[model samples]
Target: MYNSNYYIPDLVEIQRQGFFNLLEKGIVEEISKRNPITCFEKQIEIFFYPEYYRLTKPFYSIQQAIFYKKSYVSKLYVPVQITDRKTKRVFLKWMLLAHFPLMTNRGHFLLNGSARVIINQLVRSPGIYFRENMHEIYSNKWSEKPSTSFRRFYADIICLKGTWLRIECDKDFSMWAKMKKGPKIPLLWFLLGMGLSEKYILNSVHKPMNLLESFTKEIEKNQRAKTFKELKYPYVSTSKKAWEQIQKLFKLKKTLRKSSSKNTFETKKSSIVSSSFTFFIQKRTEEKYNKNNETKSKKRIKNVQKGDPKQNSEKKIGSQLEAHELGRKWFSNKFMNPRTYDLGKQGRWSINKKLGLTIPIEQTTLTALDVLMATDSLMKIEDGFLEIDDIDHLKNKRVRTAGEALQEILSVGLIRLEKSIRLKLNGNTKQTFIQKNSFFNFHALISTRPMNGAFREFFGTHPLSQFMDQINPLAEITHKRRLSSLGPGGVSRDTATLAIRGIHPSHYGRICPIETPEGKNTGLVNSITTYAKISVQGFLESPFHKVYKGQVQKTLGVFFLAPDKEEHFQTATPDLRLTSLGFLPKNPIPVRIGKRFVRMRSHKLALMGVSPLQMISVATSFIPFLEHDDANRALMGSNMQRQAVPLIRPERPFIGTGLEARVVSDSGHAVLSKTSGYVIYSSGSKIYLYTF
Candidate 1:
């Protein structure tokens, strides 16, 4: 019944596109964002703005690579332009970046003569996730572990590239900020260290006067303790110490300067005049214009005098402010620096979408505003004004495609390359040698080993990497489409909790619930549903028919929606009374809208029609009368079908699933005639045909 216009998405499209994207634009984008590499001196800036890139013919064919035990790779060359800041000249050169591995038509890579597939990694999406923590405490006298419990709320601002920020609230309603495994800092102290004023912090809090007065009492009481260890604010003895601690947390360079207060006015004035105030008159000569001009000049010189108590007090204040500014910069760099922290477009979008923020997506780092707003949201969550995220929900998780995986590997390689380039830039003394021979020596500076090693490490040792299943077409397709939650950024088997390993309602249509393995990988690994596809945001979505006034019309069109999106509408099963026009449900039908179950009139519902085989994967869907069999048996049947060997005398099943033709056609086993012909001679292994 399938027509040319009736589309069935290519099962292996994700893998194919992931590799092609890496070849076409992934490398360029990664390098472009990290463009204008700077050395420690900051005098020379090297730019890797790729004009364009192409995949040249592979050095060896796939067959040859497999036979010779060699990698099937294509040389990647990019035209890099280096702008000499000192010389004010730009030089363009074509450099061999890497010999990137090539993917075959079967959506696999030949890495060191072995066929491997990068399994899609399912990880928690980068965003602000609010969670409530419950701590159970027991008294020693009770002789048991669970005597009492306390509850607290926290929010995590997770990043794609940088350190994660965790905001926690204590029993006293005081907040704390912790950066990934670091000691926690009082939120008020953190805000102050980030350059926010007391007034601003007080205004942002609900009870300003109360919080300040309580904090003041605690500080006063703790000040009397013999040692700093007795103080509640262990890390921060003073506001200045808070700033210093913030600086230390980020490992920023020491920017606080010591000003010599003992220098005489003449010494200070002379140094200031020679080094800075060149515009001021050196001599009180007769060349002056008027008395007003001379008076103004004299006043300016007096302001520069060191012993002027006003100037001295001002310098102290200026120095403190300078240190504070440096503290703020160091703090901001932890979340805002592109080199240190990057939220990425997806992360930025998730944050904006969840928080209802209008942050530009291109600004792919958390701003102070983003943090402040997220903190406010966390406060609201504590008060039950907002909901905590379901960590296992598909909406909160995203797929890491092969392209993204490769991008991360390339990023690591680039970092290594940057370090080497910096070392060379620092060592070379002759400036002319840098411009002339440096370009030629650039070939040596660029190493394919790092990238190649990274690739090998990923494809060889990674948990998500697996040898392609060549048992059958279904097995191959399933292997490529497999999504795992056990890779680098995912949870480990030992630490994976029952809640995370259990099947979630969100997996209804997007993931095949019956196809998971029987043991440790039971729910950690899953397959995409027959009618499911990954969205642009890496969310898994399944196609559904839209219904208008309880009738599914062709004009209503097909809507592909993720689990989160489906929650907004009431969806009905496809087995509901179907007519020539569409499904027409009689009487009140059971539908799920949001988290509640409700019975509503068919005409009043914004009905969504599920596909017949939408809830199961392709291999599982091939079983006839699957609805009548036990799920365990069905799972076994599905798995075993893929391992079935093709028989020489093959015959179509008398009673089979409607997908039999499709399976046989797509299996790449049986040969078919291209044009109308008659078999002149037929044998067991040979057939001669007479064409039209």
Candidate 2:
């Protein structure tokens, strides 16, 4: 421990109300100050931007590798460095200003995707993982049930125990936290009503019980602790032989080695610039090999309609019925005959009167909202809904439900899952669980140390391990050039720019509910719902996709979860996959048209436009696209609207272990029950009526 003379307050209440300003100033200053190799501010985009869009979840974009040391500076970017260490004194030393040149917008690069490699590696770096600590935090903030969307950390470091580096690979940054700040820079986030957080605020308001206060007592009960098990708080117990033994075993030392050599910084910075072109770091090369066995997975999406990716930019998609005519008029390569569909331009006001609406209804979405409108008026749809976990079909794995089934399946190979468990098969015996052979299951170190004393239930081990061994996705943003120099960074129009998977604005729409029929006016008339839209004429199937200013996390139907594998250094990985069951109706609706497609409304999530899945979820429910540091739960609390419940609340069923959806209210932001159109694949199935 350092001399007691210099006391920097154990917890520097980070109390400077002008927080956004402070952050803005700090970020701008940092980026500008570290120009050149240490570029600070960047647009901070994901890999590529899709032309079409929707909102099953924020389009997936890996954090291409980002490299910067203390010295290099000068670039247009907002630099924010967050490092956790044992001492406040050494924290700043580890900060790095990252510069990402590519995002999800422009799509793939010939060379190995830089961001993907870096993010994965950083999070997976080996070190003493504070797995238990990260899981403890997750549990306190989120439920144990495998959430469609959840947060896990990659890595973190602690100074104690001889300059220890504790990477809690289990904790993933939360998009809920990231989306809070009004649309500003990509990473900049606002802790709206910082005191209103479920993890801290609510817990702190009623009674002031911090982590240390509650757990201190039990940590002492078992005095024969291990090296890492030193009690984090003062415990109420008499000093005894056991205590002596624990002390003898854990002679914690604050490791304060000389600052990492300046050369180390230089090497990393050089690597940053060198990385832009092509990096052959053994570190990088070997890592890719580890997952060489992994294959690119594509889901067997049924109702998915192929897109024509070569339409002219001037012609807005879904604008005219003769879109096919336009295709022939424009591109020599013809695509979807605009006659059948103008790629996601349905649900619009129509001069004709076949669809049965006064004006025209918005058919711009493929969501539950669309489902509510799309299902034949005569069909009876249920009022209540179930959670649909976005599952990785190839990886036949079930999410962690609020039960012992997941663990049982993991350990014993399967659990009892019967269709009529509640009736014929002795409800208890009917539950069936089967395990597959392909899940990348690993035992995590974080799961070993139990932070919450009694809550460490029997099946806690696996969760704890999953929390620790989760892989870290290392993403690198390679500037357009392999080694583009500083003085000049300009982009040419149509010269694809790098951006994360984000949603294109809903197809330029005059109204929503373009497809849904109007009812007795709530004082509003001559209007239809503006369906979630997309311009799918040319850019339909881009790797990444998203919509902008989409509804907040209204229905948490989809999730963008990032896993980490490193120890002590809680960074996030970039395996951004969408997880949520699309249709979880209590009364299973059989699909009429396609096996892959469902009975829901269909929206084409074109390149720029997001997937209908995304829009519908965001419009009515929650899709906390990004990740956050502290607000470690499903969403940032304010992401959901009360009215969004209907869309987010409906039932559903997916082909996997039974995992239902749950609803959560977010009192953080202002939202309303507004209807929008989405592109969904329509089908036939048993339907229930939940009419107003």
lDDT of 1 by residue, 1-692 (tens): 22233356666778877777776777888778667776666766777756486668998898899999999888877777766677576767777777777778767889778888889999998888999998776677657676778787888988888898887776657677788665565565456555565556555654332222323334455558655446554323323333333334222212212244323432332232121111111111111322457775455345644335563343332333454555566677776678898887888988898878899999997776676666677777777788888888888999888878888888887777777777777777426345454553465456677667777777787777788787766787778878899978898988889898887877877888778777787778888877777776788887777777878765756788877788888877655666777657578887768667788777766656565677788888878788899999987887787787757676776766666555545444457677778899989798889996
What lDDT tens digits, residue by residue, belong to model 2 across residues 299-372? 11111112223312211224322432332332222111222222122222211121244432333211211111
User: Residue 407 in candidate 2 has what lDDT?
Assistant: 19
Clashes per prediction?
Answer: 0, 190
Deviating ranges (above 4 Å) for candidate 2: 1-31, 34-213, 216-219, 222-596, 599-692
Alpha carbon lDDT at 632, candidate 2? 25
Model 1 lDDT, full chain set: 0.69
Candidate maximizing lDDT:
1
How many collisions between residues are there in candidate 2?
190
Q: Per-residue lDDT for 406 in model 2?
A: 18
Give the residue spans of candidate 1 off by over 4 A: 1-6, 85-89, 137-148, 205-235, 238-318, 430-439, 645-655, 660-692
TM-score of each: 0.81, 0.16
